[model samples]
Target: MSPRNSLLLVLGMASALLAQGPDLPIDPANSFKVNLPGDGPLALVSADWGRSSATARGGAMLVDLHSTLVFKNSSPRPIRGVSLLVLAQEVTPGGKASVTVPSLDIQSGESFPIRVDLRLMRPLNAGSGALVQVGLDGVLFEDLTFYGPNRLNARREMLAWELSARRDRKAMLSTLLQAGPEGLRRQLLSVLARPADNLVMGMQVARALPPTNIDPGRVVEFAFLQFPDSPVELLSGEARMTGTEARAPRIEIQSKSKRPIRFVELGWLARDEQGREFMAGTLPADLSLPPGAHSTIRRENTLRFAKPVNGLTAYPSAVEYADGELWVPAYSSLKDPRLAAALPASGEERRLAQLYRRKGLEAVVQELRALR
Candidate 1:
């Protein structure tokens, strides 16, 4: 039997079994099925697929999914968190239509439900019931360890790329320093003219933008609006804007937690007294504030925007902290999705992916491994 027919037969059997239970109202035959490897401590209890709709998006069929997955901890160890990347691989290869289900905790032998509400774009002729194969990808532990097949191997690939990119950056900086201004300008132009083979090189070339002479007297004036209510209080600070540039000097902050903060992202917003608002962007500052310590940080941001602004009131709308393991949003705070969309992918990532498409994974690995 073809895989599609086998899946249909299995769906029929599962449907009959599910129909026997009073709580299972969903029809299994109509629902897309997902199969997970059975070697893990967490076991799939039941998956109730919800309604699906199809539409056209950019010459492809976009499938909107609404489903829930129930996983029970079958092992003795309590699970504090589970991060999963639910992928509809058969419908869209390379797992383009995947969603990272937010982390959730499940106690030993207890079942927890994860709701999926994401879109999947597939070939127009793939058909609605073309045996949509689903794969669960990503790490399964609090310490961020992988237990399943790394189909994408995104983690390792990114790690290798980042390590290599850092080395390339250091090398470029040393070379540029030794070359001086005229040589640096020539090298920058040459790198920019070449095809983007490496993101590190591209970024290094981009950062060599000719320094702008700011008119100190004509710099757009800005007032210190109230800082977002956060654990880190802004004790003293001032910011000035000058044509896509924002300079924050003498910024002081106090950390209330015992854990040292490694980084902070303060989202910028401009507001008027009449209630008009604009998402200015984000001011990301790296810091080393020891436990319950006070620290000062400086930021120089080249804000990208085309809108005219009257810096009547400018302040941070959100905050995030990297307490060691990971960067978490501040208490009762969430990142504005619009801001995230505006940000560009890391230079190394774009260049490496392009390299992969042009040269292949072997070439990518060779280049990465060759990095000192």
Candidate 2:
């Protein structure tokens, strides 16, 4: 063959070889992965399962879930006949039961939206609520082949569990607090201090803290007063300081747990320059914090739209806007000396002042846009 032709032949052979090489194994762990529409998978994405007002009807416990299932298909192939399974477990001690939608199809490269209308035929036998487990179980192929739980989709399921757990915990805490301080404490002790065979409930209880005792000019911190196995630690005694405006102010907390600790919720009572008291929720935007190390939970000037404006200001007076109504901390009161020292000095207080000066409504909207 001519030299040029020979070179061409060799290149052709190399290209063929590359094409024929074995395909990389799909991560066994991700074999069940399914990508939904929207930002990503529906399994792990946070969703609200819309609420239903329950009224006793005879002996049956009646609850309905009127929520949309947003499915995004990132795959090249069209998806047809998707099955979604929702497990509704009684909150009290009992066996679990579920509902299933066997076949729903979606076009390839398209988003499929489904509204799940669920009715709980049997009320939770014992507990005040029920645990709802929603998942995508099967995807049907055109050729009659079946795909089980997609690992990616399974991840979405895990995320759903997390989101549900968080919401439930919040509801539980809110109910407890509504019963008043003593009621809150009783609920905490019963839920947290008690031992349970249900891992989910235990985990939820593990994150619950006692309500704060709000006092003017105080910063109260609650450590893992009970759970030694807790995945978090309280590094420094909670310190309170005043006068944080320009610079970001933070509290240094040391952790002994191996798992990462995200500040899911933070409660505090403070007074603004006007001497107006308020209850505040101080958890940062990005909730995740490292574990087995010292970390700082800082107060930034940025406002979050998702957080309500009720709790942002200190009690008696509303400074800025309330993000959410503040709750009392678990152990110490707002007047505790330890709490008072935790407040920031003047320079550190600028962020909050700026937020209020700009007006909370506009500032929060801008902050939300920045997140996008």
TM-score of each: 0.38, 0.24
Q: Best candidate, lDDT-wise?
A: 1
- Assess each prediction's global lDDT (C-alpha) against the native: 0.49, 0.38
lDDT of 2 by residue, 186-239 (tens): 443444332222111100111212223452234534332222333343443343
lDDT tens per residue, model 1, 1-372: 999999999999988755433321224455367766677766888876667555554445556668788888876665544445555445355335444432334567889887778776566555455324455564344334445555544333223333334544344444445765444345344433444322111100011123446544124444444425455665665545444334443466677665667665554544323344454544556677777788876644344434433342233433334532333232223223432222233344345456556765455455544543
Q: What's the TM for model 1? A: 0.38
Which stretches of model 2 miss by more than 4 angstroms?
1-51, 56-60, 90-105, 122-130, 149-372
**Among all windows of ten consecutive residues in candidate 1, which has the lowest summed lDDT?**
199-208
Clash totals for all candidate models? 0, 56
* Candidate 1 Cα outliers beyond 4 Å, as residue runs: 1-37, 56-58, 88-105, 125-134, 137-264, 268-270, 274-324, 327-372
Residue 156 C-alpha lDDT in model 2: 26
Tell me which residue pairs clash in candidate 1: none
